[model samples]
Target: MTDWAAFTGFTGLVLVVLLSFAYVSRGVPHGDGASVSFDDNPDRETSLDGSRNDVELDGDELVSAATTENVVDGVSSTPIVPTPDSAAVSSDLPTHLLIANVAVSQALLGAFLALGAWYAEIPSAALGISAGDVPTKLGVGLALGLGLYAANRVGSSLSRQFGFTPDEALRESLTPESRAGWVLLLFVALPLIAGFEELLFRGALVGAVAVGFDVSPWLMAAVSSAAFGAGHSAQGRLGIVVTGLLGFVLAAAFVLTQSLLVVVVAHYLVNALEFVGNELFGW
Candidate 1:
């Protein structure tokens, strides 16, 4: 018999490495760098009249000042503020690339896992990949997704009240400027993310470990959920904790219903609601 646990574990590792490379290559900075700040300099500042006097540096000290029209080295002395078109292009490029990379990678990974399951001779039903009651599953998923969203809102409020700053990376990713980008995120990337993660964690990892080790399903769920949380380490401590708890709930739902569709829908709804809330209400 093949060591299914090892196979699934290796697959998960590869996915993480690929995703991390994509993120880093796109210069998607995490933590403090995710947000734009304008508080570095207090002495060299703009005036209240929306204009600035350019200062000439002499041995690292300001020696003289001139108006915006003053020329320096045969070039215009005015500060070049980015045009709206230029700014949009610069911002949209990274966001588009990141979303595309995630969506494509996840779709491919989900397909690969399905093929692996077939090759391993695992029954589809055993892996919770079979179709069940569609309407009921969707309803349950929507309800659970809303519940999680509400809980997350409350948690965020409490965190703010306690002086904990929110995750800037998350906030940036959810707020897209272009309508096309937002549509792709909601319809393409979110589903791919949900499908791939659920298939990997709840389906492949849990199923393989349960069969290979002859362990209880719940134990496998817990172990796989932990791995799921670890995969989200880029989101920081609170993100990992909240994602872990959500993964646990998803695992339990899988165990109860034996339907991958249910969990995928639930996960997608959760992400969708998060983006919508963030965009509409600044949640």
Candidate 2:
């Protein structure tokens, strides 16, 4: 029998991922300039020839003895200074690409969240999880801890040829507030993130391939996980490889547990650790 459900899910996923990539490359709207504003009003209009009747200044008069016209020997003339308004305008010019990137990033994330709610049926209210459940939260934390350790170890080794150190690198990535933040994020934000990822990558993509290609669920899992890693290549070559490996782990978890819930929880835990460690400890 045709697995119509899986095929539909996979098609939806391809659309979502492509849109996300386009959005990230484009960035999002950061809003109008918040920098200083200029007031171009002058005290009085000065003559272009350098004469100002209000200031009693001679237009053509040479004020310095070293004026080029007054110089007896060969010398370069002093350069003319441009008006402040001209300089200000030049400096204040905005880059169109930068603005476009900002706009794209914001628009893309909004689109993804909306799609998740509309198509994936992830409840908006349930997006953020609670931290009150200590045992479950810690389990999530441990999964993240393991994933992070493994990823860091592998990533560090690969990047070591370029003089990067994993221990110091991980420490530098985390911050105190971010530590607290990720703890909350692990409990709250991670689930939401994991839910969407699983829906897109595992539930949608892997399921689709398994049905359409008449392949084993395991093979489908591997392919989908690989795609997930490739999506993160923007982080860097090594980061991409690490992310891909992480995706494999996630797929394996799903295969063993057969529960999207478990994999999502695990993914969230690992990401929380990574984000927190980077922000708090500077690793």
Candidate 3:
């Protein structure tokens, strides 16, 4: 009775447009430079006590001085210097705004999924949301998460060796510039991202397609994983491929455990670890 094909198509189209917009906006240069550069100008030098004595200006344009330490909250802070050509606009979104956006998006997704499940007459268990063996599901999910992370690392290393650059969009969005950014990433962004993605791709999309078409679960997994990868177009070609493969693994886990909790935990761990490694260790 459910028009699963139409539903899947519409969802895929919406995701594609949103991802494309995110990618294109990041690609557009915010100012007049492709990159930022810092240079030394003797006239703008700091004193021996790490204090600037002169405020340098060029044609009414304020020049950001070289790195200076500023104490904030009783800790030494690295002054964010503007680029030689253009001022550095803070890429970090306000914490409250970011959290509110994520919360609203997740709430909308939850509502959509609920409606879809009802329309399809699909049992909650079939969508991997019903209560199950919690301990076993968590264990399997954690193991899969670790394995996926290792695979991603190896793949990334290989890509770098082949002259692959990191995705600018992802870097801009995920890399935190302040303590507040880190808190939002860890506490808000990561969980909502993981939960909503797994629910949509693995739980809703795969389940509906499989039920509506009477196709094998593997086939539905393939379809949904492709959409998942497509949603990451900002990450470039190799990123899409790698993400697609990883999506399949998550889908497989969802199928095996028949528990959304397992896949959500695994997805959360993977994203959290990636952000932490990138932020703390520059990996």
* Best candidate (score: lDDT): 1
Error of 2 at 29 (Å): 18
State, as a TM-score between 0 and 1, how close model 3 is to the true structure: 0.67
- Candidate 3: tens digits of C-alpha lDDT, residues 210-267: 6666778898899888877656543545455567778899999887777888888888
TM-scores of the models, in the order given: 0.71, 0.49, 0.67
lDDT of 1 by residue, 24-113 (tens): 432222332221224455234332112345444554354222221121111111110001121222244466665665677677767776
User: How displaced is residue 150 in candidate 2, in Å?
Assistant: 4.3
After superposing candidate 1 on the true structure, give the runs of residues whose Cα lies further than 4 Å from its correct spot. 1-92
Q: Using alpha carbons, what is the TM-score of model 2?
A: 0.49
Candidate 1 clashing pairs? none
Error of 1 at 84 (Å): 26
- Backbone Cα, N, C clashes tallied per candidate: 0, 33, 0
**Model 3: pairs clashing at backbone N, Cα or C within 3 Å:** none
Could you arrange the candidates by lDDT from highest to lowest?
A: 1, 3, 2
Relative to the unseen true structure, what is the C-alpha lDDT of residue 87 in candidate 2, on a scale of 0 to 100? 19
Q: Which prediction has the highest TM-score against the true structure?
A: 1
lDDT of 2 at 86: 22
